[model samples]
Target: MGAVNLYVTEQYLLLKTVDTLQQKYGFRTLFISDARDEFLLEKYDRRINHVICIRRKTFDWSNQLKQDIDSYLRKFYQQPQLFRGKETRFSIVYVSNLKPVDSWEHLSKTMRLKGRKNATVTTYFVDEYEGLEELGKLTNTIDKNDNWKMEALPPISEQERQMVYLEQKIVAIHQHNQRKFEEIFQFGKTKWTFVLIIINLIVFFLMETQGSSTNSLHLIDWGAKYNYAISEGEIWRFLTSMFLHIGIFHLMMNMIALYFLGEITEKIYGSKRFLFIYFLAGFTGGIASYATNDAVAAGASGAIFGLFGALLFFGLHYKELFFQTMGRSLLIIIGINIVFGLAVPQIDNGAHIGGLIGGFIASQIIHLPKKTEGTKQVVAIIGLITLMSAMFLYGSQQTSASENPQTMAAIAQEYVESERYAELIDWSTDRIDQGIEHEFVYFYRAVAYLETDRLDAAEDDLFRSIEINEDFAEAHYNLSVISERENEIGMALEHVRKAIELQPANEQFKQYEKELSQKSTSG
Candidate 1:
């Protein structure tokens, strides 16, 4: 063959190799040079991530080989770095028609050395210009001697037409991949994310303004997750508690997490799906907290964790994209949060776990944007309903005033706040009959008795409360009220003094003290 024909054969071989790898082996085009001599293609699966670099031109080992290798590494590193950091394992193939030079005897050894730094490199020289048995090793699909045969070089005009066809194919593949990426990661505007953040901020401000959120009384009033309240037919607490935060610090941490997680989740899943996942997960968390904990709990942590679960769902569908972008880091972050929650006693980890599971199930039910799987979605919906029903039933059965002092206290305060005196007395009487001897239970019952003009019963309960805790300032003040009603001026004076001594800053106690002193002097 003439020199011109030899060069044409090389060009034809490179084009043929590129087409076979893409059309047969499923490698997508990554980057192609403007001069049509060099290109990059990648094939990724659950098992491996691979990149192939091919060029029509050849270079001697002592010439542009080192520079070309550096350039490939630089470009290869950029692809991964754009989505995620450079922590994933890399395998690169350098292909050309150059025969091995005598000075390049140590090349394979050098590549193996670089493998220690988490990258493996291999080079193939297409000496025969027609076989791709070596390229098949990368995918393990092409057997030896199963070569792809090509026709002899055609006329110059025909060769030019073939080259143009190859160029168009490359451009089409590249454009398709870009569109797929955008469709997966950038589905819609972050409308619900911002709306949710604003709603949370408004609720937080409302809680802060209406009696401090830190107070247990205010927390229950604001619809914090109080198990006893939920058992009392207040099922809306599950949803309302998601909007009520415990404190300013809790609100800030959760809102920040919500902002970041919600932005991506809404864009990936669209606004409506994101909202469904968020609320369902939050309700799950609230119920989980109700079943596992008897304390007053409130925050957006559960809903934010649901957003994490949403991303996890996305990861299941797009494994390569997730790992390449935020998979490893996201897993590490979740692990750290779980560990931290376990280490800290105050953190509501039950809600976090419940929200995560709920978010995943909700995502399964909704599926991803522009995709549908009816069977999985139906199964997910059924599973969620069953799980939530079981949890709610278990939580209801677990509620016992005798077993949980916090629940007893919450029940007492809730009744007293609403001034349900008669109902308060009946509930406390039933609990007392069951041997529940909590101080708040006795104190609230005394308040109910006093309000209903049952002075003797009120006095008896007051003494019981004072006996349980001698520093019960409110109990002492109520006892003074009973004594004054009986016209025992000296007894009223003594109890009022003790109440003022216990709580010196209470204006109510001070004013009562003055009235009792005046009565004692008049008598």
Candidate 2:
């Protein structure tokens, strides 16, 4: 086991251990300090950290040690390079302060070690390291104790991975709770947080009972944010949509975030400010969605992001607690979410970003529940929010697409399905005035026209829809139905065949094809 070349963290001097290992394998010692010192690196004038690379003599360390070692470690990592071909070089390299990401599979292209023949690199994190696991992966993390008491190390176990995760969670929780003892006693209540979670859960249950949570129809009827609906003066959709969710996983994820972030933020800002920020952020998210997206969106993601923003604001106000305890973790969480939003498909990231910004603004407006309050800063905050609101309202009223074409289309289709042809036509005409001339809008309008015995108008709208989108399967199928109704069997056959070809898996289209074929044969 000693010859295998991995070491657990130790507290005392390893001189005797190093001497024993040195007899079997040649190794070099490099002591690195993660602490900062007021020294500059040579002529670069760059501030140097407390790191020192020692061989027989000392080497001054740059502040950017990770950037320095990622390349330096490449000499030890497996590669078809000059160093790998060399013999009589390093057999064992004992590095202190633990160079990170050696085992993370994602870093293989860069961190993969292909060192000199039979070379092994053993690493350790020391007492002064004072590291954060959230920054990166680390091994040997089961804390024997916080003090520097020397003891024999236990064998590494698989449970250490779970311990690492638990430790990260603990650190995250600790960051949230690093207030002074007096402040902890009067922690903000989470009445609003529980209320919000319960309301979301109830709404999700209602959604599951009706149809799939992911179903656009179910979501729209349940007051999910639809820009067209909002423009029609259904402003309540903004608040209602925030409580709705698309699936169990979506609901679970947001609720978990709320359980953690919401409680802390609400406690920090008080119930009133927390509630205000949550709803306002949700409203802002709705506005962003209306402006940018043409789909029905439902989730508490915006409000959850509001909580994150609120925490950041708290950190900013309490500079000491934030910088020393919370800032890195908060920034890391935000960065991760932002990256995930960019990478994942079907995520309502507009809502997340919009809510983050909106919540931050609200945090400034509504002062934290602290002894020291800034009256001037508060007034400035209100003025900024008011100015932003006025601009958004003016722009929304002016922009034609802000009326929500997709919302109109979804509503129109619902009306058509229910045989409310007059209402469908009215809504369709109203949306057209708002500049919503999308192919779905045209197609739904045509369906209403056909149902209301306006054949000529129906034919015109269908042709326009098909012209706008050549590959719209529903449009082609509907055109075939219109042709058959008008006794044009050949045209019906052509259109139905096109529909079937576009969506071969659609059984309805296949049935329509068979019906059209029979009609052509009879004619």
Candidate that scores best on TM-score: 1
The sequence of per-residue lDDT tens digits that candidate 2 reaches over residues 381-481 is: 77657744764575356454344455556567667666878877877787677676678778888998888879889888888888988999888888888
Regions more than 4 Å wrong, model 2: 1-179, 182-186, 323-325, 372-376, 383-387, 394-399, 402-423, 433-435, 449-457, 467-476, 494-522
Per-residue lDDT of model 1, residues 1-523, tens digit only: 6666566666665776788779976777767788777877766644545567777656666346666667766776556432233322333444455644646534423263243454556655553444445555544523244545445557766766776787788778888988998998899789888888899899888878877877776787888888766887899999999998878888888888998899889989988899999999999988888777777889888889998999999999998778767787789889999999999978989899999999999999998988899998999999999988988888887875434776577667777887888889998997787676778889999999988899999999999988999999989899989999999878887898898899999999899889888877877
lDDT of 2: 0.61
Q: Give the Å error, residue 367, model 1.
A: 2.6
Q: Which window of ten consecutive residues has the lowest lDDT sum in model 2? A: 36-45
lDDT of 1 at 446: 93
Clash-forming residue pairs, model 2 = 77-113, 77-114, 78-113, 78-114, 188-267
Task: Please tell me which predicted candidate would have the highest lDDT against the true structure.
Answer: 1
Instruction: For each candidate, give its TM-score against the true structure.
Output: 0.72, 0.59
